[model samples]
Target: MSQPSVYPSVSPGDPSWWFSDALRAEGGEKPSPSLSGQITVDVAIVGGGFTGLWTALALRERAPQLSIALIEASLCGSGASGKNGGKVHGYWASLAGMAANIGADGALAVARAGTRAQDAIRAFATVPGRDVWWRESGNVRVSAAPAQDAKIQLYVETAKRLGVPDTAQALTPEQVADYCRSPVFRGGLYLPEGANVHPARLARALRKAAIEAGVGIYENTPMTGLTPGSPNRIATAAGEIIAREVVLATNIELAKRPEVSRHVSVFSSYALMTAPAPEKLAAIGWNRDQGLADLRMFVHYFRKTVDGRILMGSGSGPISFAGNTKNPALTTDRASAARAEKGLRRLLPGFADVPVEKVWGGGIDVSSDRLPFFRTVAGTRIHYGAGYSGHGVNPTYMGGQCLASLVLGVKDEWSTLPLCTRDVPKLPPEPFRAVGGRLVRWGIIGCEEAEERGVQAGVMMRGAAAIPKVFGLRIGTR
Candidate 1:
């Protein structure tokens, strides 16, 4: 088979509305030259999304003497980095999941790294004259249904038991309404460290920073093959790259390799953006400008843009068959898009009539454990990282930190992170992976939909939800 594509198949006529808008704001981005003939560099990074760009920047910061080249099948930030919901927060809200996946100490370590990363982004974003549309209001997770309320309780209880009570606190129904009133919501959890940003603009800033720092970027260059050895060789259609060290930060594209495929699979996430409605937003009292979501297996994450538009996203899209990550219809199906719009109308009905200005979707590399893992290829000087799942905006920073340490061969805090050595559970191979994923997905949809309707899902749907338990895997791999 041909090498997997770095970008999924309309992801964005020019990436996405975020990307196109960012480009329009940029007064037209200067094009980067694609590779031609042959070239050699000290370090070669693949996949020009946030992970790859951050790695290049980190390498430049650590070793300015090293010559670095970043290759992109499309453009930097044109992948998930540009297509995301723009929630720029850390893992305080995910404390329970982290503790469950790794140990408490490990969980604390990753959360703290996330904090540092968030701070780093804030620093970069606040630099005078930069326009990433960053807002530091924080995040909220509302329990839209009574069954969903349990998740809010768990997030708070776990944080308190871990002696970080302030990291995540339980909120009353009134408190949740204070942020964004909705009859469906019961209670919620609040994380003060959360923030939001124009994801594509951040991606653009990184691209500009990388170029200014002397990192050669090859856009529209897809690697067709790789030869792993002392001097790794990466071949593209028109040129090839030879480098002493290599980094595969190519998101779901890495899933093409069995080692990664067994641990990570692709699932589509869709987002719907409403036309600017500052008045509609005010009517709902959603003035806090925080990232908001409902507690569900396939969560609905929503946030406001600088232009007064609300972007609502659903993580409940279908699983790719046989690990085929390419999203033919921009990674969306009619059902998923409908669910996203349903989330917007059901949760924040104030904007129910707001015209949807844009719709975009893309595949996310979800790990078996729902957390990312970083590792070096066995007996090779190459590093790879993926499985961001749906909560990558903040963790990709941690990814860059960890991957950078590995490339430098430095045994420091970042290099020794539990994520670097964790043995995440492996998902089933092909046919079963995709087939089972779809079943569980339907199960989750059935259960959540029933809960929302104030009823119990049928036995069959509930049993499907329990299938992951039988296989000793985390629920909702889809």
Candidate 2:
């Protein structure tokens, strides 16, 4: 994932080359000005990603009189929030962990909340002028190997045992082929609660919604420093925001802070997009627009855009050096891009000839538990949440509610959810962290490669794949 320099997202000759261009162009708000002079607010939120935006929206809905200011170093949604695959759904995969960590009742509550988050997004899209490629077509996690098939079956059983039955169901090979004609797909679990979105557009919609909800937003405003106090002061390039409280919902950008960085490890995820090919799509029976993902530790996720282009992304990319959150070189990994395209060709051979329109990558902050957690930073008024791993779209919404409940100091179910505490296990420190991540990632790649070849992974490779789970941080346990 390391590169010589950061790739410019857009160039004079390559406008609209990326899939997110349309959404950015159609975004409702122009960039807000950078913070200037001194400003005081009830709450100052750092990071304009979904977690920040949703927290702001939730705060406003809960208490309209509370003054809120949201500041972003770059444009809102420019980070993982904007760069993600836009699969929104409940965290059915985390039910096992939740039940183990919390009580069964608590786990059920969290699961229900996760499902409600999906409905909330659908409702948000109904707002006039906020259509964000809203598609409630659901998501399917297909298994191409026996191990994956077993995993999906376990997930179905877990879902039912957790009292969220019918949230996910196993699809037979014939049923899977009906929706997508992929030779690799033996079976899958279909979650009707899922939906796909145009992520950038969704972020834009949130920005617009925040503004309409009376939120003060400042773009190009990075929090350079923070001083803990009754009304903590956040220093930026142009000014400082003194707020009664602050919410750090910056996702992988959380690694910018050494303390936060230690608890999370960052890795790059790459995606590739193809030109719209309606004829080719029809030739393969990909008429359904459900989001698809393989069952692997380092998984591949794909879906169709409204324009009919195929978007393929793989999580098997490079791990960042310790505390290197903003390394530009990781933005575009050509090698990972090639692998994603290769995966797309394997899944949909009929569309192999389609021209690739764009390729991009973004960072993921992984916690030792591979789950999102919220907590109040020690000796500060700062509340933070990170470690969404790669399955964040819905969980972040849940994160927003949890953060809002904590900020308002209300004792409710959200505040009681296991994710609301600072109990998430931490990753190992520097050298070991880096070395271990590489080994685990290598093993994941080897195991998946063997699976693709229809051969069992070697004992050493399986052991590598088990390293993360050994620490209870299953890469794609869901």
Candidate 3:
């Protein structure tokens, strides 16, 4: 099959108004070309979203004298960085999964790095002109069924053992009902360190900050290829950038680059935002404003937007290799929307009438172990950081900082984390990749079906409980 198109067409007048509203509110400028062409810089960064912007900012702070340039394929944050769920929470997936690949000690180190990354983002929010809709409210992972309760318990214990300083409390059924306003959740594990953000605004703010700090940024400039040698040269459609070093911050988009395609796979995830939910909130009695996620292999994560709308996200489907090939027929399809809407109603049946005002989908980079891959491609000054799994918001910032430190030849706390190294293995090729993803999706669906039945009966059945581990996955514990 021919490669999928890299650019999918998006409607400018869609009901999904977050991107346009955010751009206007943030006073973001339109993309422009770099004035000085063929200029040499200390570092040349590809991808001007959060990863590249953060990398530039961190590097500037560390080595003020170094010159840097950031090239964007489109506008900054126009990709997944801006379109994500905006939950800047803890580490990706589970520590158990990370430990399975990188060992327990390494996993703990990675978790600590993530925690520090979240702290760093919070600190960045305090800067004037850099503030985005940042709510320091914690995150809660609710159990959709009794069997899933075990998964939450496992997370709580794992957090403690990993030396995570945040409080992980298991809420009782009564507490879940009172706080979450959802009767379907038997309980949940609440962590105090989590936060929600306006992803688009944050990306714009970071790019703005980097530009103000004397970093050169070029937009609508796509890097098509790379030439590695003593000094790396990045080829764009219009021109080439020759710099002492280069960084690849393109997460899922990395699949478009032949050099990095082996290390990343593109997977599509869909999200929906309900119309203003004041009435729904009143009925649910959940005004505390914590980000909520469910415990499942393919999970649902929702959070309250600043405008009082609830953003719900679900659905992980395989997409064509070409980046822009979306089946509009599949966008907000009944089955996918039902996964999110049903999850919301289960938590707050009182809000079952809330209409979904907007639905959008984006792609994520998935690595073999569901952990991020950060490394310098062998014998070259080109450093890369991608494969954040589904947890890119906070980790992207952290990964950027680590990339900055690595480029500067500094060994700091974040740089020392095991995830910063080039140790994680690459995933299998296309056919096997497609097969493995299908198996994972089947396992997750089976578990969700079992839980729905058990919840209706008010007890977990033995047959319903064994789906996750039997399929080589981790489920949170009771």
Candidate 4:
């Protein structure tokens, strides 16, 4: 008889097969002891995930003498950092959208910063003793439908116009099939700068590196209250911390604050990992390790693991009601996992018989403009950055560099990128936000379905897709 699935339903990203088992191996980093008494530091960073960890490392690199303390609600890599699809690529694909929001010059600056960030990750991944399973095998943004193909064509034109010709190149159907056998793929855009890695391993490696660099890390320590004083104070469950500066790298948790929450919405995304299918993958000619994402509004991102299993994710999962990121419902949903698995099967028929090894879900903080922004919170000593729209793997590194610059009060190039702005666009409030979100979601699905059927979307569907654009928002599978 077939053995029962261990994770029959979706659960928090924490106990996923990827992070849990690997973390238990001999010599895997253990959670740092939590803070228990009053203490002070030069910099106090909340959130031990990618953003905070990167910030700690960046600070040490720039100012080796500065004392830094990083507090986490759980162990490092327990959140999205460990649970993500492990895609670390630049933001060149969003150049047109960035240019529309910030002028072309500003957009170019952001793109350059993104490129630098990608390179930084590449360097870190290859360094000795990291063991992060980093692979710079590039990525492919493919099209399986007529509408998606149309958008891919526009993206290629924009990349060329933006002088990023070497960043992305068009791929013929035959060429795309050579990389990954998918009959639905009409064409693809290949980016050689993209990379994939073992996310949990990277996070753990960052933790080890940060500690070795003399940064104090306290896990299982949650920051509960913030008191604005001459020097800001952070209250934790069993201790208090006074700091010269604070960096709030808590990505999804930013929704709890009105100033930042209004501009962000929390949504859940699901993924399914298949049992090792080395023979099947070879049979399908999917020998390349490049990460792949389809051109649907709600993206279908898939990549092969170092162990040869395919990990597939779907972005069209549940959204929080009333723009609340703290909604417990955002944690997990089995239906979402099923949908993601179905998408994976549709893309690769060769995996039809492969048993799913596990299923998981996690929250993502999406901005109204579908781009990340960073700046000091108004009238406060805190610096913050979030809103990756489900594409944060590499951007978080850029965010860390920007946060480090702000904490040091340095007015250099990293601090002036388009993302380092004070004006973060806000979404509509409650009822309207909820209703409008449904319409947009339904519209995206409708348009994608029409395209799959080789037909144009109807008036309603078109209107729904245009709603966010009408409000000057960018939404697509990037």
Tens-place lDDT per residue, model 2, 282-401, is: 877888878888887678899888888888888887888884766654565666766777778777777767777777787788776666788887777789888888888888889999
The C-alpha lDDT values of all candidates are 0.85, 0.79, 0.72, 0.82
What would the per-residue lDDT of candidate 1 be over residues 156-236, giving only the tens digit for each residue? Answer: 789989989999989999998899888788899889998999999999899999999999999999999999998999999
Q: Which ten residues in a row have the lowest lDDT in candidate 3?
A: 1-10
**Candidate whose lDDT is highest:** 1
Q: Report model 2's TM-score to 2 decimal places.
A: 0.92
RMSD in angstroms, all models? 5.0, 3.9, 5.9, 2.6
lDDT of 2: 0.79
Which wins on lDDT, candidate 1 or candidate 4?
A: 1
| Per-residue error (Å), model 2, residue 394 | 1.4
Put the candidates in lDDT order, highest first.
1, 4, 2, 3
Candidate with better lDDT, 1 vs 3? 1
List pairs with backbone clashes in candidate 1.
Answer: 12-15
TM-score, predicted candidate 3 vs. hidden true structure: 0.87
Cα deviation at 277, candidate 2, in Å, is: 0.9
* Per-structure clash totals for the candidates: 1, 0, 16, 0
Question: Which ranges in model 4 have alpha carbons more than 4 Å from their true place?
Answer: 1-7, 12-14, 26-29, 453-462, 475-478
Off by over 4 Å in 2: 1-24, 27-29, 100-103, 458-460, 469-478
On a 0 to 100 scale, what is the lDDT of residue 244 in model 2? 95
Candidate number that wins on lDDT, 3 or 4: 4
Q: What is the total number of backbone clashes in candidate 1?
A: 1
**Cα lDDT of model 3 by residue, 171-270, tens digit:** 7777777766776777887777788888888888888789999999999888888899879888888778889889988767666665556666666666
State residue 346's C-alpha deviation in candidate 1, in Å: 0.6
